[model samples]
Every structure is written in C-alpha cells, then in structure tokens.
Target: MLLIEALTTGGAQRQLLNLAVQLGGRGHRVSVVVYHLADYNHRDHFRGEFERAGVPVTDVPVMAPWRRLWAVRRTVRAAGPDVVIAFLRRPGLLAELTALPARRFALIVSERTGKEGGRDMKDLTRFQLHRLADAVVANSAHLEHYVRTAAPWLRTRLRQITNSVDLDHFRPAGAPPPPHPGLRILAIGRFRPEKNFLALAAALRILRTTEPALDVTVDWYGNNFFLGQQPTGRSRPYLELLDVLRETGLEDAFRVHPPVGDVVALYQKADVLCLPSRYESLPNVVCEALACGLPVLASAVSDNDRLVRDGENGFLFDPHEPRSIAEAIRRFAALSADERAAMGRTGRRLAEELLSPATAAVRWADLVEQVVEARRAAW
Candidate 1:
C-alpha cells in the first residue's frame, strides 16, 4: 500500500504516482490510499492512470482530523498489505499510527522536503512517528542530512533514494527546433514562496535593463494553489510574481501558464531551464530538463549541486539575489548555439547516470524487501 495526501501535480505527488505504477508493473500488489481529492480536478488528477495500470486507489476523503486517521486506519487494516509506504508528512504520520505494534507488516515513510522552521511542532511529531517506522526514506543526500540532524534517533532507520524521471518519455528531441526570435527559458513548479518565482521575475527585469539588445523570454509554468494550506487574504505568490513583472515593465518578457500535463512538450521548446528556488531536496524539473537535453540554471540549494555541474551542464546562482540569477542567464545567453547544445548533451548524460526511473524502482524494492525480511527475522 502506498499512501499520500493527494494526487496533485507536485513533484512528490508525481514521483509517488510513478513509483506506484512502476511497482505494480513489477508484479507487486499495489494500491494507493489518498487522504483527499480536493486539490485537483478530474481532468488533471492521476486516479485514472492508477486504474489503467491495474492499481486500486482508495480515496479516504474524511475532512475531520481524527476521522481522517480512523478512515486510513480502517483502510490499512482491510488491505492487509505486506508493506505500507507513505509519502510526505501527513501520510507518514497516519501510516505510523495505523501500523502500530510494527509486527504485522513493515512501514516505510518517505520525506521529500528539507525546509525547516515554521513547523517545529509538526517536525517534532514527524520525528516521534519516525521512531515507529521501520525505515524513513529521504530523497537526496541533503534531505537525508536534514532528517538525521532533525531526529538523530532515527539514524539507524534512515535511507536515501534520489527522485527519478522517466527517461524514455522526457528524452531529447530528435533535432533541435528552428531558432526562435528570442531565447526561450522555462521554469516549472508550484507557486510557493520557496520556489522564488518572484526572484525570477526580478531577474528578468534586471536583464531587460542591463542587456537591452538580448532577446530572451521566460515561460513560467505552474498553478497558484497548494493543498492543505489556508489562503491568505493577500494575493497568492503567482499573482505577486505577475505584479512584480508589471512593475518592472518586463511583462512581455515573462509569461505565466497554469500547470500542464504535457510538460515534456514545453521542455522540447525551451532553450534553457531555470529554477530560482530558495531551497529544495532535489527538484524533479531539473531531472526532467536534463533528460530532455535542456541546460539548467538553478539556485545553489540542496542537492542541485549533485545534479548540475557548474559551467558544464548547468549554472548555479544565489536564488535570493536576483542579480546572480540575471548574471547566470546572461552567461547562458552568451553561449553559441553549438556550445549550448553541448551543455545540454552533458546534462542528458548526467540524468541517465543519476535519475533513471528504473534505478529508483530497484532501490525502493530493495528497501521494501529488506524491511519485510528484517521484520520476519524478528518474528
């Protein structure tokens, strides 16, 4: 059984969906247990894909907190899965509570983010739950470090499994498309403050003033909404970004689009992929862009250093400093067409070596089998 908050389009959600499908394809009896389906509409939700892959999906849509726990507990007891793997915080907490006694089945909880503060109590709760889980998985070396430092008692149970991308689906284009009038840059992710979309807009404004002759355009792709968070009366982050673009008079240069399912097509059209995030465990967009042979310019945060080799496949900037981002963009713009293509090819090689979905699935299955055997040995 794989448990998560919901089947939204975030990186963690997509990764969980892919892993569930992959594990099911590997002859495992897999089912997904979601807390609610409030964030996504039917058109964009991944429930259909789960069904198509012969994986059952149980939607435990209870709104009340304790009721949600009871619902998940009931579902888990009925499913009687050999192993229950939960993604993110809420699911991890519920899975830990539901799989008490730890003797009946193995429990593994995966943490996707490395950010800290503003949730000390929540983090402490997750740490307490981590003590109950058979294993706690972190998706990057950076995230693993965060987990260990945050809850040193769980060091024995810690496991690292980097996020993966579908190489076959996100591969490079057959031939580079004809050059557009300007450089096409792409940024994809949620509109959270940590993602720093406003910083990207600020950087575009700087570039517009500094490099007047440079022809460059940025296409920002993502939705404004986030799950499980109350909306402030103030404008959302996406709207804030739009306001920044207008104030900087760079509206024409930066365009925002809602999140789309066909993201590979956007990658195919882009000359470079930029991630101006304040922090991340490891972004799926970076991996997908690299797989599609698109050079990247990401912030110097988390495990980005592991994926992007500076001056080779991609460049890193201080996400807080709009000037740094603008400078990196200028450098990428200066590269000749052939030079840019070479950099993209290097990124593709890195993706093949590090972010293949097959490799990730193998790692996950190995961990699952290890935990189950360890539990049986104890018995």
Candidate 2:
C-alpha cells in the first residue's frame, strides 16, 4: 500500500504513481491510500490514472483530526498491504504511527528533501518513530545525508533512491513550435515564496538589457495552490512576478502556464529548462527536462551537481542572488545553438544513467522484497 497526503500534481505523488504502475507490471498487487481529498476530479486528478491502470486508490473520507487516524487505520486494515510505504512526511507519520499497530507489515517512509528536511515538532516525532519503520528512502545524496544527521539511530536502514522519471514519455519529441532567432527558457515549480520567481524576474530584466538583440523568453509552468481550489488572490505571488515583469518592461518576454497533465511537449520546444527554486531535494522537473533532452539552467542546490556538469549539461547558480542567476543564464545563452543541443544530449545521457524509471522501479521492488522478507523472518 502507498500512502500520501493527496494524489495531486506533485513530484512525490507522481513518482509513486509511476512506481505503482511499474510494480503492478512486476506482478505485485498495489493499492493507494490518500488522505484529505474529497474527490478525484480536482487538482491534477492523478487518481484517475491509477484507476485507469486498474490500481485501487482509496481516498480516506475527511473527518475530525482524531477520527482521521482511525479512518486511515481502517482503510489500511481493509487493504491488508504487506508493506505500507508513504511518499511524503505527513503520510509517513501516519503510516508509522498507525500502520505498525494494525499489522506487523513492513513500513517504509520516503524522505525527499534537502536542507529543509526537518521540522521542530513533526520531525521530532518522526525521528522517534524511525525505529518502527522498516526502511527510510531518501531521493538524493543530500537528502540521505540530511536524514542520517537528523536521525543517527537509523541503523534501521537508509537507502538513496534517485527520484524516478518516465523516460519513455519525457524524451525529446516533435520539433518545438515555430522558433524565433532567440532562446526559450522554461521553469517549473510552485509559485510560492520559496520558489523565488521575483528574483528570476530581476535576472530576466538583466538579461533583457545585457542581450537586447537576443530574444530570450521565459515560460514558467506551475501553480501556487496544489490542494484543490485556489483561494482569493492565491495567484498573488505569480501576479507579483507579472508586476515585476511589467515594471521592468518584460511582460511580453515572460509567460506563466498553470499545471498540466503532460509537459513533454513543453520540454521538446524549449531551448533549456530552468529551475530557480531557493531550495529543493531532487526536483522532478530537472529530471524530466533532462530526460526530454533539454539542457538545464538550475539553482545550485541539492544533488544537482551530480545531475548537471556545470557547462556540460547545464549551469547551476546561487539561487539567492539574481545576479548569480543572470550570470549562469549568460553562460548558457552564450552557447551556440549546436552547443546547446549537445548539452541537452549530454543531459539525456545523464538521465538514462541516473533517473531511468526502469532502474528506479527495480530498486524499489528489490528493497520492498528485502524489507518484507526481513520482517517475515523476524516473525
């Protein structure tokens, strides 16, 4: 069984969806449990894909706080999953606290963040409950180190699993839409304060002045609100970016796209993929772009060093400094069209070496079997 807050358009959720489909193909019966979602028609509606794949997905009905635990427990009990794994922190807590008592099923919780991996209250409890989990899955070397430091007693088991990307669907496809004699930049992430789009706007403003003849345009794809409906002016952060663009006379040079079910076409058309997040563990966007044979321009955070070889596949910069971002952009923009295409091809090779979904799913299946056998032997 896989547990998560919601089957929304997020990285962890998408990874689990891909893993579940692959696991099912490997002759495993997979079921999903999600908390706090009212229906399957909302958000990214990833639940529909699971259903279409014939994977049973149960959205535990919303209820009072205390009752929700029981609801999750009841739901898990019904599913009778031998191994209960959760994709994010909140659901991992629930899986550890509840799934252990209901059955001796092996529990695996995934930690997929870098520096901001811990919290004051919830992490304390989670660290204490680490003993109960059969294993901890960290998606990057940075995240794996973070977990080991925070919970040193995890002689239990900490495995670094590169977050999976669908190489088959994400590869370079049809020719990009009518191309102008300029560079196209693509960014994907939430429109939150952490994403630091305002800084990106500043960097783009610099790019406009520094390279007046070069037609550089940015297409950012994401949403601020991921749960369900957007609250009043929830797009304020995205709009503020627009304000920055308009004030700097860059409104025409940038475009913001809402979340989408598929972004392969976006990757195919773009010259490069850019992620300006202030922090990230191992962003799915970077992996997806690399798999799509799109050169990357990303913040120097997490294990991006392993993925991007400076000027080879992409350029990484200090996300905190707009000038730093601009400098990296300048480096990428300096490359000739053939040079940029070569970088993208190199990135695709890296993706195959590191982020292949087939390799990832095999590792997950092997780990599950090992944990399940260990638990069974203990019993």
Candidate 3:
C-alpha cells in the first residue's frame, strides 16, 4: 500500500502513520511519500516516527501545482504497490489521476476536511477526480455527505471512518503533574488561521477580566509554523482576533509551545481543552483531550455537535463570539471537582466507543477490501 500526503503533523498525518504501521505489520508492504523535502517542524518529527516504524518513506520536491502531476505519476509508477491510499484533497486527486493506467491497483481517496467549496480550485478538481477512485473515504459522516454532493455517482462508493488516536498512548494513565496555582487552559493543533488561536487568546483575556479571581494560564501546543505557504482570504478573521489580543496587552498571559509528540502529557496537566476553530471537519485534539480525562470546549461545527453533548461532556460555543467563549470557560472553571470528573468520564466513554485506533483501523481495512473487491468485479 502507498500512503501519499503533504507535510506531517495534524490529525491526518497521525492517522496515516498509524494505518501504515498497523497494515505493514500484517505482511502488507507499506510506503509513504511526502511532497516536501525541507526540514520543517512537522516533517522532522514525522520522519523519525516513520523511520522507527520501519515503513519505507520518501520525500520529493514539487512546489507548483502542475509540477505535482509529474511527481504523482513518477512516484506511484515507481512504487508499483497493490493499492494507493491518499489523504487530503490535493494528494488524493493526484493519486486518482496518476493511477488511471494502473487499473489493477485500487486507488482510495480520503477526505480530511469539510466541503471547502469553490474557494479552492482543488475542490473542483476533486469533484472531477472522484470517478477515477475505487472508493472515497470520509473521516466523518458530515464530510461523507459533502462528498456525495460533489460526485453523486460516488455516493455508493463513499464510506465513513473517523480518525483515530493510539488509545494506550493518549489515555489518562500518565505521570501526574505538580499542582499548579492557576487554571491551565490548553489548546493543540497546527498554528494555522483555521485554528483560530487568536480568538482563543482574546477569549482568555476577556475571561481573565470578567472572573478576576480565576488565575488562568493559556498554553498552546500547535504547529511550529504559520498555516500554509500563502494566506487565504479567510485568514483575515484570525488576523483581526490577533490584533485584538495585541492591543489588549495579553501576549504574556497566553504562550504558544512548539509541537511535541507527547501531547498526552499536556492533556494530563490541562484543566480544559479549547478548540476554537474557524472551520473544522473533526478535530483530534478534542478526542485526545477527552481520552486524557480533560473536559473540552469546542466550537459547534461539522462533527463537533455530534461529538460533544452540550453541558454534558463539554459545552459548545459560537466561534465568532469571544464573549460566548469566555462564558463557557467561566462555567468550566466553576464546576466542582466531581462535576468536572463526570464530564471527563463521559468524554472518555464516547472516545473509546467512537475514536479508538483499533476501531478506525477495522473500519478502514474493511472499506479497502470492499473497494478492491468491487474494482475486480467491475473489471
């Protein structure tokens, strides 16, 4: 099997790594092809992890859009694998296009984001590339719905498999931290505008003022660099929020940490996990935090409503409203120890049932087998 993706880190990278290791151990040859060769933050860590797992990994240089086609064709043909599995829209589209002549091998496309719509030309290309794939995989049911709309013919070919984390590694079972004086607010993800870290900072500032007695410290563990190669128009919202934080003079209150492999340690120390994203299909941090027995406060978007039961495991707030976020933080901070523990337990139960690595691998394995069988029958 060949797994193709751009960069590493984020939920998508971790899922791919887990799948490669699991599938490779079962007598299946697995190879990973990353498009970037530069030693950025995520790539550095991922290179080590992939090497440790004994998976054959390659990094090729292809910066431009058109150049990617040649890169895709060259890599897939060179690997000559039984199947090619790709994550993210661009790499998936490339896999489908390049695997056209290699009809004996099945091409699988995985969607990690929501319907990005016309904002990106790649969305249109993905729509056109759908028919070339043996199957389309969506991490959430909400994303599957969007996929179906993009390519109606692929509706019968679409399947849902939520992203997974290593349960044992991410569990509440970790070394305890020394008791801290303040309420430690933790957030994790890539340092992209989509993450809306600025909004989180603004909300923390507001909460500090409104609830002065609450000693609060916000710690962010996100991607070491800013979002993408270039900024999108949607970036303005995040920039505005950052300006608010700087103007209000709260830079010292909230600190951003470089990405680390042992996120479980941060989750264990955190009082609450905040996922204030402008957009998200499904976030792995919230799931990881829940598995670590930390309550979550996330924006109600896409699968968030399905994952988080308001006032149960955690509360959902409007991403556009800083005041709403502040209030939710206040509510979480005010909860009794028992109440908070109950919320954490509820989150863990949900994660065990829905987001375990074993569960995800089984689902994906079944889907890949089915797609391969269907392709054989079609021939």
Candidate 4:
C-alpha cells in the first residue's frame, strides 16, 4: 500500500505515482490510498493512469481528524497489504499510528523535505512517530542529514533515496530550438514564498538596469494555488511577484503561466532553466531539466550541489541576493552558443548517471522487500 496526502501535481506526488506504477510492473501488488480527494484542482489527474497500470486507488473520505484516521485504518485493514509506504508528514504519522495495532505489516515513512521546512512541534511529533516505523526514506542526502541531526534515534532506520526522472520521456530534443531574438528563461514550480519567484523578478530588474542592451524574457510556469496537503488559497505570493514585475518595468519581459501537463515541451523551448528557490529536498525540476539537456541556474540549496557542478553543467547562486542571481544570469548569457550546448550535454549525462527512474525503482523495491522479509522472519 502506498499512502500520500493527494495526487496533486507536485514533485513528490508525481514521484509517488511513478513508484506505484513501477512497483506494480515489477509484479508487486500495489495500491494507493489518498487521504484527501477533492482538495486538488485536477482531482482525476493520475486516477486513470493508476487504474490503467493495474493499481487500485482508494480515496479516504474527508471527515474530522480522528474520523479520517479511523477511515484510513479501516481501509488499510481491508487492503491487507504486507507493507505500507507512506509519503509526507501526515501520511507518515497516520501510517505509524495505523501500524501500531496491526503490527504484522512493515511501515516505511518518507520524509521529503529538510527538517527546517516544518514547524518545530510538527517535526517533533513526526520524529517521535518515525521511531515506530520499520524504516524512514529521505529523498536527498541533505534531507537525510537534517533528519539524523534533528533526531539521532532515526540513524539506523533512515535511508536516502533521491528522486528519479523519466529520462526516456524527458530526453533532449534532436536539436536545440533555433536561436531567437532574446534569451528565453524558464522557471517552473508551485507559487510559494520558498520558491522565490519575486527574487527572480528582482534579478531581472537589475539585469535590465545594468545591461539594458541584453534581451531576455522569462516565462514562469506553475499554479498560484496548491491542493491537498497544504491546501492554499492565498494568491498573494504570486500577486506580489506580479507587482514587482510592474514596478521594475519588467512586465513586458515576463509572462506567467499555469502548470501544464507537457512540461518537457517547455524545457525544449527554453534556452535555460532557472530555479531561484530558497530551499529544496531534491527538486524534480532540476532533474527533468538535466534529462532534457537544458543548462540550469539554481540557488545553492539542498541537493543542488549534487545536481549541478558549478561552471560545468550549470551555475548556483545565493537566492537571497538578487545581485548574485543577476551575476549568474550574466554569466549564462555571455556563454557562446557552442559553450551553452556543451553545458547542456553535460547536464544530460549527469541525469542519466544519477536520476534514472529504473535505478530508483529497483532501490525502492529492494528496500520494500528487505523490510517485509525482516518482519516475516521476526514474526
């Protein structure tokens, strides 16, 4: 059983869906239990895909917190899965609680973010509950270190499993898009403060003032709101970014787009992929961009150092400093066309070596089997 908050369009949710599909293909009995169903804009986003892949999805009806817990426990009991893998904090906590009474099954909880991402109280509670899990999965080495440092008790159970990219689908185009009049920059992710879209706008403003002759246009893709888990209705972050653009006279140089299904196409059309996030566990956008042979300019946070070799495949900068971002952009913009292409090729090689979906799935399967067999032996 694979448990998660929802099948939203976020990186973690998408990775969960991919793992479920791959696990099922490996001849394992797989099913997904979604905690909240209606909270997402594209509620049916991965439902049909799961169904077609022979994975049943159970939606736990919404109710009070206690009732929801009861419902999830009941659903798990009905499924009678040998092992339960839960993603995100809430699902991990619920899985720990659910596995207590039914100790026959193994429980694996995934921590997708750094310890600093959540409130102290919530992190403490999660750390306590994680002690009961058979194992804990961290998406990046940075996250694993964060968890171990915060709760030393998790040292034995914790394992780092980096997020995977569908290399076959995100492969580089036969040739780069024909050079255009201006540089085309692409940024994709949820519209949240941590993403620092406003900072990107600020950097662009600095670029316009310092290098007025440089022609660059940025296309930002992502939704203003997120569903499931942290259901947000606040459009203020996105609106503030728009306000910044207007104030900086960058309104004409930027465009905002909602999240799209064909993100590979966006990568193909873009000259460079920029991620100005304050922090991340293991950003899937970076993995996908590398797979698509696009050079990156991202914040030097989390596992970005592992993904990007400075001055090799891409450049990393201090996200807090708009001037640093502007400097990185200047560096990228100054590269010759052949130099840029070489950098992109390096990125693609890194993706193939580190972010292969097949490799990640095999690791997931091995961990699941290891835990399940250990539980059976103990029983």
Best candidate, TM-score? 4
What TM-score, computed on C-alpha atoms, does each candidate reach? 0.93, 0.91, 0.89, 0.93
What TM-score quantifies how close candidate 4 is to the native fold?
0.93
Model 2, C-alpha of 290: deviation from truth (Å): 0.9
Error of 4 at 22 (Å): 2.1
lDDT of each: 0.85, 0.82, 0.76, 0.86
Global CA lDDT computed for model 2: 0.82
Q: Per-residue lDDT of 1-379 in model 4, one digit per residue for the tens?
A: 9999777667887788789877887899898999873354554555766777788888887678989988999999888889999998889888999987658888999989653354487787889889889999999998898889889989999988899988888989987788788789999987878898888888988998999899989999886764543445566787788787777788888889877866899998899999999988899899999999999999999999999999999899999999999999999999999998999999999999999888889999999999999999989
Error of 2 at 20 (Å): 0.3
lDDT at 33 for candidate 1?
A: 85
Error of 1 at 111 (Å): 1.6
- Candidate 3 weakest lDDT stretch, 10 residues: 226-235
In order of listing, the candidates' clash counts read 0, 0, 0, 0
Q: Stretches of candidate 1 above 4 Å error?
A: 37-44, 101-103, 116-121, 226-235, 377-379
Query: Candidate 1, residues 1-379: lDDT per residue as tens digits?
Result: 9999877667887788789867876788888888872443322466666777787888887478888888899889888888999998878888989876544788999889868344387787889878888999999998888778878898999999999988898999998988877789999987778888888888877887999899989888876664434443333776777777788778888888767866898898899999998988889899899999999999998999999999999899999899999999999999999999999999999999999888889988899899989887877
Once model 2 is optimally superposed onto the true structure by TM-score, how far is the C-alpha of residue 178 displaced, in angstroms? 4.9
Error of 3 at 283 (Å): 1.0
| Top model number, lDDT | 4
Question: Which runs in model 2 stand beyond 4 Å of their true positions?
Answer: 37-42, 100-102, 116-122, 174-178, 226-236
